[model samples]
Target chain A: MAKRTGQVRAITLKQVAEAAGVHASTVSRALNPATRSMVVPEVVDRVLAAANALGYRPNLLAAGLRTGRSHLIGALVPDIANTVFSPILSGASDRLASDGYSIVVADVGTNPARHLELANQLVARRIDGFILATVSRDDPVVDFCLDQHLPAVLVNRAEERRRISAVVSDDALGMQLAVDHLVELGHARIGHLAGPETISTGFLRRKGFYDALEVHGLPAGDYPCEAAAAYNREEGAKAARRLLDAAPGITAIVAANDLLALGAYDVAAERGLSVPGDLSIVGHNDMPLVDMVAPPLTTVRISHREIGRAAADLLLQQLTGGESSTRNVVLAPALIVRGSTAPPRAQSRLRNQQRGAG
Target chain B: MAKRTGQVRAITLKQVAEAAGVHASTVSRALNPATRSMVVPEVVDRVLAAANALGYRPNLLAAGLRTGRSHLIGALVPDIANTVFSPILSGASDRLASDGYSIVVADVGTNPARHLELANQLVARRIDGFILATVSRDDPVVDFCLDQHLPAVLVNRAEERRRISAVVSDDALGMQLAVDHLVELGHARIGHLAGPETISTGFLRRKGFYDALEVHGLPAGDYPCEAAAAYNREEGAKAARRLLDAAPGITAIVAANDLLALGAYDVAAERGLSVPGDLSIVGHNDMPLVDMVAPPLTTVRISHREIGRAAADLLLQQLTGGESSTRNVVLAPALIVRGSTAPPRAQSRLRNQQRGAG
Candidate 1:
């Protein structure tokens, strides 16, 4: 058998399409879930039948022998356990699965070096495309994925240099919705428990809150903003305390994430203040349990599942010989008004302090 | 290449091992991650180097062609995004990864019949083993997976008839702990919101709670138990209300799962009852957000991750032919004391109810 030495007689997807009497790209699309719907069912069946008859099963290594194309797509995720990334993995996997291609994912962990090793393994596996959910400013992985001429898509993040295909919700819109919901409750002065500036979601959402105030024609002061070290609640609590201390006149706090909102809720109670009555609050991400909270926090809802599906769609496009142009898929966000926010108190300490009595 | 027909030269793992100057089993162990560490580093290095140099990449498919053993395992899960399954998937995958095996998982929806098609695909793929997490009391998949002579393992659920290779937490011990904690809190008339009896966790945990109370010499009349339709929050709320009506004097409530616990919280709020003060509540499955809730949940902390890892360990044993007989793994549960349960109200509500009746 010549050791089956990872070599095969060269055959092209184009020939399969031609044999099936379909466009070459149509065969490509038919093999992919994202574009499969665009092809007629009969045509898809014919193309798949022809491919099977030809024994054209995706042989990643043997393809490495044929056209030197591995056809393996790679997905990188920060945390697979998080609800947000579940759909992304499912979406990308499903899309790639249809096209006789498979996805290999690398976990982004507390250990950055581990991620590098995982990336190298995927590269060694000869991944021809990549989807990165943990893109940071000036990421080396991004450079490596791109330098190899591997089609790459980013989820929830964009490189500082721009021009990367990304599927991210408008953090600015998310923050604006939260701010507007609080302001509609008659909060005169609002503060923001912002996430870290290091992350795109944090940086954009914080700026979005300030921009929202200006858009709503309100005078904004620098005291209303406090950035946390990270998106987690411990950082949220620290940032919330600083926000309240710096802006004692603030009637409501809009947390960049639900965990941060929870932190603010705790700090509010520890200081002998009652939520909604003493101070109103809104959180972002609409994460689970926020609705079950004591006052049922008001927040913005982003489609986590949609984000996943879209990211996968973008990756499949690149895999199927589609344009290499960078596409930005910005999903919309909406406000969910619950019982958390209320009007400023009649004996408003914040209002009195803002009148120059502080 | 003789058309690379179905019949091809067979290279037994035995030959590969002998060629590498090692025992056949050691070669098998060297290729498997679980047993890789057991092989000395020098021997492993030699084996791997020799195998690569000889182009001795054992064809997983070719092995199935000869022995009808695909060396593939199939895992079925209810919800991939659920926090509980994350650890389980990772644990199982990590265990299988070492053995040069991959576990293919499919999401089982409301109608389990959908699993039939997915299972057929796995069979066509010639999967040698099955690891299932969503087994009901009378699962047809059980007879199917077993009849195929395919080694199968169940997690979180067990078959009613036999000792299958299953991994589950000691739910009875978990119930005892909940009951003991509530008793320590001085609750006399307690209510239990149980999960669906259609699943093993539901049926056993409910029985355990009753058995635990009996062991404590508490009369069955002192407790009112209502089984939820499902473990989800809505069913939990329904079960909680049933418990409240069945035992109006109930001072404490023990729920089967965290979602049911959250539902009980909603019912308590609706009745204008204060948690821990008027209606102490205890829950199982320390799922995410329980800690973030207004009053953190007091529940049994079962290691979802550990369960996953344990299941993986069990499957690897089967895959590597280490354990020929079927076995079940039972994990211990820890009780996490949180803010949800407190001493029965000083005013004594159950005593007051007795007095009013008198």
Candidate 2:
């Protein structure tokens, strides 16, 4: 049983050897990647010629039939077209493809709350395990997969109770980068447009922002934090407006995603306030659309692709009979300064001038 | 002989009947979409409830095994982001999914021109047939599949030799609509930006334009045509420039696709010309991104979803042993008038002034 995306059945070495009238061991030696040296050169040539003629496909299922050895790991993304998932999926797919592994991708839109269904599919087909990007902290899918002793890894999410393998970008480092960049430009009052608390990334990222604010010794009341129900354009804009209205003294904003940052831009344009002049803004994810959206948002650029690749690697390791040793690999985030961030407005300069005169 | 993606084994009607504690015939009636209602109401409920409880997966392969009617088909698309194929794919998926048949989709970018490899995969797994959206006019994959006797259907492409089932949009009606629209707008000199000749669409659409022009009693020289290498933005711009440069008197252009029309936008912008004021453009494929671009395009909209549904129906008929007859379904296209098209840039007014002065 050779399981690939297309419908090609695999031919076993035993079948190939029998068809070629060669000893199984001789056929094995001829086909082995490492040991074809001891066989007679002419015999090896003849065996290969016959094998090719017979269309003897490599029996992947028979080779990796055991648990922790199936060599197939899955990656579940919420959406394929949102651009943020594109590089991540491509990276994981490319890395795994070279290792003779295939990613069985299922989009959440096509299969809603797909973990249980996908898990059932993978388990029935003897797929080694999975790399889930769309995991909730208290997800039933995570609990079920872990309960079965299935080798699995989480991407972009860290399970609170289930200590499985994970590859996440340092959102704390990202927040620090955002805050430090703003401080360097002499902005005092800052606000954060946080994402939904249901997901781990959103919860942890918001916590990181508050922690950073405390570390900077800024007045907590001065910097308001508005929690959005989701990390999307409309939610971001709604959060940004509320954050701005609540914290009237705020000079900069830290958005949860690029889409959020764009939403903030809309709010600013509505109020007739210029970005970086009236407000300094920063966004995360740095999706492809943000670069073309006028001001080119200042943001923390994380390697979403590297995160996906690392997740696949961890899942593959687990699939290859490795012990269920819990591990979390965190990639660092880099601050990319575009046109969205700068010094606080001239109103602050006038206040400073008044203070100097006094 | 288990099929139905990601499933374990084929569940039988006996199992469903035994679990439901009902007659096998009753279970069969409940499962069959056509006769499902004929079963006793309580018996049907019991069978369905029991089947869901037991996860009674119908092995599409096992069902097809005895009857040789596996309702599995592979769909190949060149690009996913291209709006032209999105509706078609979605439509096919919907139509196939309703009949307990699931489509195995392969985005060609992941494995370009590896249709042989894909075909072999499908063949190994017992794919009954295929619906290919990316078939070229003279494709090798077509020849290979024909030789192997794999049931196949083409969408948007008609084989020049006409050996396979195909579903195409009426390019002649579309061309006539564009030509008549331009002529009614008082434009005597018009041109066409034709798509690649290698594709059946490109060839037929260009031919349709010639046929429509002759029927409309327009001189051949009055409407020149430039062939585009592909249905893309850059190609449209290049083709537009060539048409404009060759026939300076031409005021209206009929573009092969929306992306090409966008390219014409770039050309008009470069030449400091306003759309509808200096030049009139008509696009095709009314894709998602086209409406988002500055000036919404005027084009003929083809029903991609309908084409996909029709192809699925045709393939399903063959798989179910219903017929061996070849099918050719040509759907009609509708003309949309948006912001991009207008009376040909006051050419008649300018011409009238010239005559009056003389």
lDDT tens digits, residues A46-147, model 1?
988988887554433433433434445666777666666656666665555555454544556545665665565555444567788873454667776655
Query: lDDT per residue, candidate 1, B1-358, as tens digits?
Result: 3321111233467777888898878987788787899999999988887677654545444344455454556777776667677567667766665655555556564567866655655555456677888746777788776655567788987666655688889989999999999888788778889888887788898898999898889987787899999978999998898888888888898898999999998887777677877788888989877886768899999887777778878877766655757777889899999899999886655544455456
Estimate the TM-score for candidate 2: 0.70
- What tens-digit string does per-residue lDDT give for candidate 2 at B1-358? 5331222333566888899998877877797778987987888788899888877655333444444444556766675445566567667756775665655554455344675675565454455688888845777667766666667888888766777788889888898898888888887777888999877788888888898888879897786999988887788889888987888777778887777777777787666666776678888876643442445678888888888899888877766664656778889998988878888755642454355456
Candidate 1 Cα outliers beyond 4 Å, as residue runs: A1-74, A90-105, A123-130, A159-163, A217-224, A320-324, A346-358, B1-74, B91-105, B122-130, B149-152, B159-163, B221-223, B345-358
| Best by the lDDT measure | 1
lDDT (tens digit, per residue) of candidate 2 on A295-323: 66899898877887888788767655464
Q: Which pairs clash (backbone N, Cα, C closer than 3 Å) in model 2?
A: A6-B121, A7-B121, A7-B122, A7-B124, A7-B125, A8-B121, A68-A319
Q: Among these predicted structures, which one has the highest TM-score?
A: 1
